[model samples]
Target: MSIQYVGLKEIKGSLIILEGVTDVAFEEIVEITLEHGEKRVGRVIQITGDVAIVQIFEGTVGLSGSNTKTLFTGHPLEMPLSKEVLGRTFDGKGRPIDGLGEILAEKKIDINGSPLNPVTRKYPRNFIQTGISAIDGLTTLIRGQKLPVFSGNGLPHDQLAVQIVQQAKIAEGKGIENFAVVFAAMGVKNDVADYFRRSFEESGVIQKVAMFLNLANDPVAERIVTPRCALTTAEYLAFEHNMHVLVILTDMTSYCEALREISSSKGEIPSRKGFPGYTYSDLASLYERAGMLKDREGSITQIPILTMPNDDITHPIPDLTGYITEGQVVLSRELHQKGVYPPIIVLPSLSRLMKDGIGKGYTREDHPSVANQLFAAYAHVQEVKALASVIGEDELSDIDKKYMTFGHAFEKEFVSQGRNENRDIDGTLDLGWSLLGILPREELDRIAPELLDEYYKPYKKKGSDA
Candidate 1:
């Protein structure tokens, strides 16, 4: 039996420091008893020469030395793994907040599980259609890759994340038949948290989703452990249960803040802006864990979402994340102010693994051709706008005039969709063709003859109103 110590050390704000403690691991949960016989819970966060710092899960109040007892379970925080975890609301540590008792789980997993060995990882080669033309047709999401949505202050990162999760689905003929999403929110506000809850319920995706939330009001140390705990659960689902899992983590900036705060508390030498020097390596350790395992039936795809501080991409958080992740979907604050719901600035957004995901068997054979044409047309449109600023629009060449028309038409027809619109591949491709119809076939250098024959819009005669 574990001995219960009656010596509760000094209460420094929200933390309780105890001396003469032994055998306590970082993040190990402990049961705390107050003098009034009320019980609470906490975790051992720091170990310093027999001095153990325990952070209370609930705020530490009315607990003093010589009147409290601390018992260590000799175990770190953990979560239950099972299919029943879906559609349930849990705390940052995977404990059910919906009035449910402890889950009779098959396995007890540590939150800080070891990273996936890179040598055993398979190269990712496939597509996951979000059913949104702006994403699939423009910035295609490749299966088994880590693609983050890079946003700035006042951007619609949350809304875009919701749309992606709501519409994301495995390709029609891929090996994976069913997929599930494990979404974890760290340091998010209550309203933003509610939006996700309502969105998942409305889309009926709750049944296939496992959600863990650490709100802004939660303890700072818990915020630090939130992502690791969520990722641990995802690893269990994807690796152990052989399921296709998409793990979405939002507001990573908040996680970094918590890291800096803890590092400051520990009195570690600071890197950039009081961040630990190993911040890059630490972030890589998390993002790199997502990928396709060789010869395994399951794969882990990560869509981590983080907004840049002050819209500065050079911020350490996004800069480090950029280095670790595959590609980025950059959101535009200007576009958000323009009343675009998603506000994804297409020019800067890209999916590096687009080639592997789109082709004859997976998507339409003309997928790449259409994407190239759209990109070229959009670039020309930008050029036209810039030239129109210098020289008058009335003096522009006929080709430039048509390019301007195509750009506006592309944004209105292809990019903008209803709030709940989930377009299929064929529908998205058809929209591309319709937008290309604005340009004459002679000017379509991006498309090949075969693609032209396959998806060409009927040509219009000269001087005919199209």
Candidate 2:
């Protein structure tokens, strides 16, 4: 059977109704060839009877009802895979944008596929030390895990992303060859594009990196295809090529907005202030694609970053992402205002895989104790800040006063660090001890004295007395 666009009829909204296709699978990318010889692609967003709902990828810029032939490739969009993909740049649809040349792909696989069985996924139990102490020391990222970063507008999340790429190191006992990075940006600026290029170039990792950029000015419809294409490439490299891949997608909010826009064009019912009701499942389809297969040496670990509109963590994008991903690295506006770089609000940021990735062979033996004590101490510090706001610091109980000091020290010493600073696991564990030292001996209930004796040192460095 051949695809011939018989006629086009205006549907409910911006969507164009096409007749003549009896059967087409869901989300299949259709190629449309115009009389003028220009070729464009669209997706089979919905189907009813012999009529198909095709959302134009580049939008129907110049088109007529006649002379347009639609070809349903009978498959969803797929990305090309090969080692040659590394350090190359591509547009939203996986076409190379770096201008060097297109990849001579060995094969292409459908982007939409069943997720790895939860039970079959190897538990992520190793940390990736991204040199920034704020991350390695606090909300550590684990390999084979999906831990997102929730940020706000005007925050330095991009800088943090750049820093992670620069500083993130392999877990001990793993060779550098076992690690790789794949970055996908949706609706970002040209300057942002240049920054990543320059940073990777400076680090000399552009060769080992692969970038898929969906710029703000590009067709909004293309945004939806960008991340999936990126992930498909990652899966090929990690699972097929046997290379460990770290996938980072920034501003997922843009991705969601594209979904909503397409939903509106389709005249579908909206949910949560005009967002499509299927958003949760759609996000799940993308996020659940990450992880290490039990039998595969190479794994895909995702760190998706998004800025909550108006700092609303309850926003549909961040809220839904929280449900599907393993954990989050939540940012804080309050902390940002206080001038804490990286400003990771440790109380809210967590890696559910932390337990599996810490202790013994993975990291320092005291890693568990150190993380627990820092978390507990900082939590109490929040309480002290609230109490001090109600009553004077002097009026508070003695223990409350210690909590207050610990809180300040946690931010100034533990959380705040330079962008270039990189801390190893031992240094991270030791730094946690340094911050805990400000509290009196009795306040160290989260950690055992034996552990403390092994790790703890007074905050004051030894002077010339040596």
Candidate 3:
């Protein structure tokens, strides 16, 4: 029989502290029953010297010191796992909110999963085509890498996330059949959550997606567990079922804020910008969960999206995330205001693991050279634009004029594709070659002579300044 402790030492925010408690484990589930028979669930976050600090999943609102009963469940919070989880919708705590009835568990696994053995990790390779030219042709998402998207307020990060969910796929040659997505949203508004649901449903990919949503009005404490629960299900699908899993975590800034609020409630010393000092390790615990295992047929890829406060990249959220994740796809407010669809700032965005995933058999033989030449020429365009602003366009050299024309064509034809338009690797590379062709062949310094000979097209129209 479990012992129920009567009365509480104190209640601070969503945390309930109990003194002289015995045999309580960290992360253990606690049931707090009030005088009026209303019950709230909590998890033990910390335990020291018979004192346990429990974070209530439902915020503590109606509890009193003398009448409350706290029963330790003696086990950590666990999530029910099964193949049935796909195509389902659940709240942040992993409880089904779809009204489709309870899941028949294959087995219950603890949500706080141990990290995979480093020796067992396989190096991530193989491209996962997202069908966005800004991504596939530039910042290519490797199958098992953790690449995040850094965006600002009111940027179309949510739409980009939906687009990825709808279009991401493994390269055609891999032939592995089972692929799944685990999407977790923390503290997002109801309309935003509804948009994701409707997008997945309308695209007919809802059958392959498992959604975990913690709304803006839900208990703040539940935000902390949202990603862990989502990743746990992802691990199950990837390792146990031998399925490739793509986990998309949106608005991680809210999760960090929740961490800060809980830390403040606990009276912990603050770090930079009033956030907890352990923020880096906390984020690492989440981002590092994506990878491929040796001798395993499946992999886990992550695209964690966080809105940069005031468009500041130096903010602790995006800063710490950049340190942990492989690379970042940065969205641009400038391009957004200019009416670009994805609004990806190509120059500032990159994928570190892209090298291992692209070229030859992965995408196309000419992909690396085309990407390199495009980057070089676009960078030149920026320099030319700055000079033109200073000395006026008419005074610039003929080569500078050509670069200016290339820049306009690049943004209009290459970066700004229709929202529903999905371009294959061949089409993206072809468009890139066409844009680069506007420049003289000698200006394509990044391309090797062999590749330039094969794909380069010179301007052919009579009296064409380009």
lDDT of 2 by residue, 1-466 (tens): 7555645765433356786577788788888887788998888888998778988877786766766677888778888777899989898899998888989989988877556778888877677878776677667788878889999999999999988887666775554676778899999999998898899889887888889898899888889888888898889988887777889999899899989998988878999979999999989888888888888888888999999999999888989899998878988988899999988899888888888888888887887878888888888888778888888798999878877777887787778888878777787677778777777877788787788777766565324232
On a 0 to 100 scale, what is the lDDT of residue 440 in model 2? Answer: 80
Model 3: residue 234 alpha-carbon error in angstroms: 0.5
- Model 1: per-residue Cα lDDT over 209-304, one tens digit each: 888899999877678677777788778877787778888998899889887876676567999977999899878878877888886767788998
The Cα error of candidate 2 at residue 120, in Å, is 3.1
Q: List the residue pairs that clash in candidate 3.
A: none
Model 1 weakest 10-residue run by lDDT = 457-466
Give the TM-score of each candidate.
0.90, 0.95, 0.97
**Of 2 and 3, which scores higher on lDDT?**
3
Residues 1-466 of candidate 3 have per-residue lDDT tens digits of: 6999999999999999999999888899999999999999999999999999999999999999899999999898899999999999999999999999999999998998886789999999998888899899989999899999999999999999998888888777543358889999999999999999999999998999999999999999999999999999999999899899999999999999999999999999999899999999999999999999998888999999999999999999999999999989999999999998889989989999999989998899999999988888899899999999999999999999999999988887788888778888888998898888889888888888999888888653334666
lDDT for position 123 in model 3: 97
Index of the highest-TM-score prediction = 3
Which rank order by lDDT, best down to worst?
3, 2, 1
Cα misplacement distance, residue 428 of candidate 1 (Å): 1.7
The reply for model 2, stretches above 4 Å from the true place, is 11-14, 397-399, 461-466
